[model samples]
Target chain A: MKIFLHRRGFIARIAALMVLPFVAQRRAFAQSEAVDSLIEKITGGAPLQRGRVKLEIPTLADNGNSVSLRVVVDSPMTPSNHVKSIHLIAPKNPRPGVASFFYGAGAGRPQISTRIRLSGSQGVIAVAVSACWDAS
Target chain B: MAARISVPQNARRGDSIEIRVAIQHPMETGYRTDDNGTSIPKNVINKLACRYNGVEVFRAEMGSGISANPYLSFFIIAANSGELRFDWVDDAGVTGSERTSIIVAG
Candidate 1:
């Protein structure tokens, strides 16, 4: 009886060990999917490039609640060349669409600075669309 | 209550005008746990719009990513004396606005 009980205990421990990792992995995958869906909704199938928009964020955020951020687009603030909109996205935040800024020729600068909350360390993306440049 | 906007009392025409605004908010994310281990409801500013001289120049859609007491800075072309208005809304459907006038000079 003792041997039988020991065997059952070992088996149960092993089963738990196996199940825990799978559960954790599943949660992680779900989070990733959520973030992807948010990005898709914000961009509306627009291609996202790496270097067009400058996203200035701290390499390591001390607080997951509020982080300072600045987004600057490399566009002239002219009537024909100014940036139409700027989208700031945080993939892992509870609300992924952090902010969207719209600017016109009347806006003297194509830059925005504000404080943002981050759930954790994650990739921050900034998408800027201009009147002349095609969506990418 | 309405949000508060602070800008220079006088701005010169042809010079860049700096505008700053701060709103009182908690900007809570639903993921946070309270002292009793209960999840807090999400509350954040979802949108902010700024208009100068009756024309819309800048607008932003905010989210939980924005911190409490949100502060935003931007600039506008100083052309003529007019009013600068700021409007913001949160996820809970709460709205606030503030406005100030500037003296533009050539």
Candidate 2:
């Protein structure tokens, strides 16, 4: 009876060990999906081109409560071809949307710097929308 | 609520000048418990707008994710000699503003 009980307990432990990774993976997948939907809502399903917007944040922040962030978008900042807005998002924060900056005709270079709070370690995403889409 | 705005006193017309603002606020995230174990309600600046001589030039919408004592910096083209006015409001309906003049040469 003792050997049988020990065998059952070992099997149970093995099962739990096998399920742990999948559980973690499912959680990670859900989080990325949520971020994707949020981005889609902002861009209206527009294709996100990856080369123009630059997001700078600390790779290993000592403090998660407040971290400095900077975003620079490549734009001429002309009257007709300027960045209309920039959105900062933190996927793992209590509130995902960090901030949104809007620029008018008087805006010059498309760049901003600010401080943000992070609940935990996560990737920060910066989205810059231009007033007019550039083919080049 | 005290706020500070930094802008160069003089800039040539068509020059891209940087503007910075730092304000004092708790930016309570609604996730913190006080000494008595009462949850602190969220109160952060919701909207901030900047106008150049009565023309809106920049605006921002911030959330609780912003750290306390929010600081922001951006660039704006110096068109003419005028006042750069900043107006912001918080979640508790408190409004604050600060203005500074800049002289544009040439």
Candidate 3:
């Protein structure tokens, strides 16, 4: 009886150990999809290059009700070279699309500041499209 | 609802000037319930647009993820002296508009 009990315990532990990574990986993938797919949809599956957008938010927000947000993109703001639009995404929010800003050549600088709400602790992503990229 | 807009009184031509706007709103998320346990309907500003001298300069699409009393600050070039008009509409189909003028020096 004792041997049978010990063997059952060992089997259960082994099973748990084997399944842990898979479960964790699935959870991570789901979270990534929530954010990545939303971004992809906004960009229309366009390839994204890094280093143009700069998003500023409190590292540790005191309240999720209203958090200040600022986004800056590198652009000269001329008729030919300017930022087309900026999209703000909060993955953990019930709706990921926080806000989207469209700009014209008259926009002197590619920067904006606003307030947003968050459902929980998560990273905020800002994507900026340049006017020189495409017609649409 | 009332909206407040601020623009520089004067700016040199070709100079960049800051513009700030704030609106009075609840921006209800519809996720909360009252004492009766009845959920509140979501109502937030869905779109805002700014026009400079009848030319569209900036626009924003907002969702429930924005906080109550939405406020935004941005920059625009003082190409000409004219009016800056802001128009916005909320989920409840209510529209609000405000205007401010800036003087650009030559």
Q: Which candidate's lDDT is highest?
A: 2
Per-residue lDDT, model 2, residue A5, is 16
C-alpha local distance difference test of each model: 0.67, 0.77, 0.75
Worst 10 residues of 3 chain B by lDDT: B28-37
Of 2 and 3, the candidate ranking higher by TM-score = 2
Off by over 4 Å in 2: A1-31, A133-136
lDDT of 1 at B59: 90
Docking class of 3: acceptable
- Compared with the true structure, model 1 gives a TM-score of 0.76
For model 2, residues B26-72, the per-residue Cα lDDT tens digits are: 88787777888888788999999999999988999999889889999
Question: What TM-score does each prediction get for chain A alone?
Answer: 0.65, 0.72, 0.70
What is the C-alpha DockQ of each candidate?
0.42, 0.43, 0.42
* Interface RMSD, per-candidate values to 1 decimal: 10.1, 10.1, 10.9
lDDT of 2 by residue, A54-108 (tens): 7777676666666787888888877657788888878767688889899988887
Q: Candidate 3 regions off by >4 Å?
A: A1-31, A133-136
Candidate 2 backbone clash number? 0
* lDDT by residue (tens digit), candidate 1, A6-85: 11111000000001111123222223676657545654544444444666776765555567777777766676567777
TM-score of chain B of 2: 0.98
lDDT of 1 at A45: 43
DockQ of 3: 0.42
